[model samples]
Target: MKLYYSRGACSLAAHIALYEAGLAFRAEPVDLKAKTLAGGADFRQVNPLGYVPVLELDGGERLTEVGVVLQYIADQKPETSLAPPAGTMPRYRLMQWLAFISSELHKTFSPLFAPHTPEDYKPVIRERLAQRLAYMNQQLAASSFLMGEQFTVADAYLFVVLNWAGVMNLDLTPYAHLQSFQKRVGARPGVQRALQAEGLLGS
Candidate 1:
């Protein structure tokens, strides 16, 4: 299997999942802005949408979307328990969190990253993100992971999104639980490996 990723992008979640699942895979870096791969091949040919986090399976099947890719990686190694078994309530709950992170938290950050966004409107986006993070902090106050004590694909996805707070200058000091959550998750071996591979962390 191979994962096409852009450093620190949402694809980081999928990359982390691959390691956490103890799966063997190759990581290929993408130049998202240039719509090219590390080999200078046109990435649009890989995915016309020109997005990162496209997973190409060993069989040549391809998967897109961070949530789907994360779940796919987890399913490949059920013993790793990166995600709950399908058709269970716990799995549904995990899906709920993934949806929430993608639609509510992830998309909200997009406007802030856009250079075309009006400066005055940036605060509005930040405020929405703060509210979302506060809600997450409250949820996390009750458990070690998004799905209680067991880590899931949802946690991986959320961690990657939360990481953007630094790039956006959105202070998370007020969200005590979240601040600690970041540290705890960041310390995980698989996550550390993923970050290091992406050059986001020192070896």
Candidate 2:
């Protein structure tokens, strides 16, 4: 498998999952802004949407979307337990968290990153983000991870999204549980490897 990704993007979640699953795969860095690969080939040919986290299988089939890519990786190595078994309530709970992270928390951060986003609307976005973060903080307060003690793929997704707080200059001081969650997830061997592979961490 080959993963096309932009450093520090949502794709990092899948990258971390791959490492956690002990999967063998190659990493292909993408220039998202240019829609080009390291070799300067058109990335649009791979995914016309021109986004990262496109996972190409050995047979050349490709998977898109962070949530889908993550689940695919986890399913590949079920013993790793990166995700719960399918059709089970625990699996549905994982999906619930994935949907919340993708729609609620992830989409809310989009406007803040846009240069054309109105200055007045920025605070409104931040406030909305805070509300979401507060809810997550409460959820995390009850468990070591999003799905209780097990560090499922949902945790990987949340960690990557929360990482945006720093880039956006959004203070995370109020989210103490999230701060500690970051530290806990960051300390994982697989996550550290993923971070270093993407140059987000020093080797």
Alpha carbon lDDT of each predicted model: 0.93, 0.95
lDDT of 2 by residue, 90-182 (tens): 999999999999999999998987889999999999999999999999888978899999999999999999999999999999989999999
Cα displacement (angstroms), candidate 1, residue 101, comes to 0.4
Which pairs of residues collide in candidate 1? Answer: none
Cα lDDT over the full model 2: 0.95
lDDT of 1 by residue, 75-108 (tens): 9999988989999999999999999999999999
Question: RMSD, each candidate, Å?
Answer: 1.1, 1.1
lDDT at position 102, candidate 2: 97
Error of 1 at 74 (Å): 0.5
Off by over 4 Å in 2: none
> Which RMSD does model 1 reach against the true structure?
1.1
